[model samples]
Target: MGDRLLEHEELLRELAAVQDWPLPKRMKWAKRRRKEQFRHWKRWIETDEAQSKCARPRKNSNPPDLKFASEIVLLEASARNDVDEVIAFLDEGVDPNLTNIDGLTALHQCCIDNCVDLATVLLEHGANVNARDIEMWTPLHAASRCGHLVLVRLLLEHGADLVAVNSDGQMPYEIAETSAVLLELQEAMEKNGFDDGAIEDARNSGPLQMLSDVKELCDRGEPLSLADAHGVTLLHIAASNGYTQVVECLLTNEAAIDPRDRDGWTPLHGAACWGQYEVIELLAEYGADLDAVTGTDETPTMLASDQNITLLLHDLKTRQLERSARNKSRPRSRTFSSSSRGHSVKRDSVNKKSHFSKRDIAEEGKQFKADADSTTGDVDDVVIGSLDDENGGNASESEQSVFSTDSAEKKALRRSKSPPILIKTSDPIQEETEGENNGSMAQRDNVVQAALAPSTLEGQDSKAELVSKETPPLRRRHRSENTSGKCCTIL
Candidate 1:
């Protein structure tokens, strides 16, 4: 065998026969069978039938380590005022609105550094001019405070709200360091179509001094919704000063009643804080939101010092509850629901009223039948004829059948049903579909909710609770020793 291996063709044959030597010696027959099968498979694979099933491999797949770096690159370029670099990154699909660790967008940083060209580039690339930082400070605020007149003009021209306040309750104009920047902001605001005269009148003087001028402007078809540098609207000022007619005039011009100032103070909140009972009543009458909470989560009643003002708010709340209860008791005939967008007309009450007698409905049905006959090719007769010809010839019978079905539907609609009050229970109880002669357990749940409604007085400590005569009070310093005047004085 060694002598035969010396020849290349002889060595190949010998190697192929002994290729299965790793197999068990007892399974030598099985190895011979496998070798024969392998030879057949190799021959088949070379044919077209086997070649058609194989697919060509793909190339240049995305690798796992490719990280996103365009935002950081764009931010660095913008900060350094490298216009070309910034442009290159932007062209390569960097987001202009991408914010940094401090929530400062490219536009904000450019304005801070007074980079007018960079700001223009970022704005043209679709950066938000009014984008607020983490502190809620807009680019306009930064530009004005930094005394960049040109950048301030650019921001105002792009429709930035000058009255927008930061988290610290400071507007752009309020933080402006120089008169030149403030004057430019005012001019830009006016040129951008603000009510400059009304705004100046509202900001420069009290409501008593400026009411006539504001009314004249309102007469000239000028809007009264302009806000001052402190984000206080003309209506807010009027409400704060207890100027009832001014408030009414502003409302007559369709001014918003619940516009909030920088500190989340609405007109009602200002009225309550100043103990303006008349303004509070007027605002409540105009449907101002009574449950609105301030930035500190204080309600109007919680901020009022005068007990009368607090009592007025409570009375208004009680009246509102009574009105809602009355409206729920009656069957509404028609309701016109007015909203900010538009008013909607709903006629559910016409079908709900049960006062119409059977005789009246019969007469109305006869009148409807007469009208249907007057019109050519009555729809019901045509449909009945197509369905069953024998029933179609009797038009009166068909009309009567239709009228009777409609009367049945109307009667069903006339049956009024009240919604059930759902009550959660710690222990599951059997559902009671009918009410008892007196109060049910569900009524107790509603009473509990009513008692829990918040209406705390101003300067009252929330941590203290009412104590019974048997319970001991916490130790405290003597009232005479407390010069802070914060001690409670019981009547």
Candidate 2:
């Protein structure tokens, strides 16, 4: 058998054919060999990965030891409380930092299972002692809540955060129900120099506070953008936790938006990673950069794992693109809209702007037209009377010529006699026809403005001055007309 390598299948068949090696002997021998093979592969992979992490050159090694048919998931191994399997997998280059679907790391699982040995091994391999799961729960939270005293001590000694608040605003010590666990946490806190007052102060300062807490801080005139030791600001905490009102308060108070935490994660990054949908939308509204990268070079968009969050980002991106495009082409569109009519006008340039809605403008236009015609008629009658006075009630041929003229000529005279009220407005008949064809209120206003265009900028300036001078007189007239002696709203 030493002369050449025998396949495992062939070896199994040979063992079966052997009379000396009975069923019990074969089973014992196979178990011993499997353990030896597993141990050998574990050590080799462990060394290679550790060296790689240290930036050292690697040596050629055997492909993964397929001693077992397949490797179990790291989470599954920890959940099963299989210390050997967990260690084997960890040794074979599975990252202790890798999380399952619930964002639970192997350390988290170890704490949940109360597996002190597994937790120790994972920590030795550099598992984060304070790794927060999806609900912002640390391993200490799991162990403390499960009343696993050994696991709690192991985690605390490994530097687990005692006062790290979870999604429900409960800390590890707060959740620690057993007297033993509570006493241990309290002792740890005292040893670490954390006092009751200090803990309470820290908790109050956190962005996870209620609106009333925020209001209290505001009353005290305390600074809004409070940061912890890790440089996590109130915006970061509120955003990650989906506290919309708190986030809005922080923002309205002019708190820093893009402040990065210890890991270069902004509030947006935290919100996206934790699947805070409304918070993500709120951040986008506040102009949070979608492309801001973390220390690991991952963007908020890349960190977003939820379907709704991705959809929200997609919509925000679409709106941003549309807004940019609209802004870029606004001047051109405005220019085109102003000149859509046949005539030229400078409506926007006028100083005395008539702020009127569609209905108000139409009503004012009709009312003004009637007033202008009445004024024209009065002025024409005065001129005709003065001509008659000049001729002394004369029967002169020129005076008689007016009445003798054709009806068309008389109508032309009356039309020409009116002030230039309709100069800015289109012919009423033409405007009606166009309005019927195209019912756009904005477009019709543009046409009126285009026709009202002054011949030159100098002319426009004179028109503005004239309108300014005329407005006070118009208002005075309306006020005098009011029998109640109250100021009339001269529209």
Residue 436 lDDT, candidate 2, scale 0-100: 42
lDDT of each: 0.66, 0.69
TM-scores of the candidates are: 0.29, 0.34
Q: Write model 1 residue lDDT over 330-433, tens digit each, in one string.
A: 99687555775456444556545544444455455445333433331222222233223233334476565663323222222232122212222222212122
**Winning model by lDDT:** 2
**Sequence-dependent TM-score of model 2:** 0.34
Task: Please identify model 1 stretches exceeding 4 Å from their true place.
Answer: 1-68, 192-491
lDDT of 1 at 438: 24
- Residue 305, candidate 1: C-alpha displacement in angstroms: 25
Residue 18, candidate 1: Cα error in Å is 84
Per-residue C-alpha lDDT of model 2 across residues 266-327, encoded as one tens digit per residue: 99998988788888888888878888999999988889868778788889888878888998
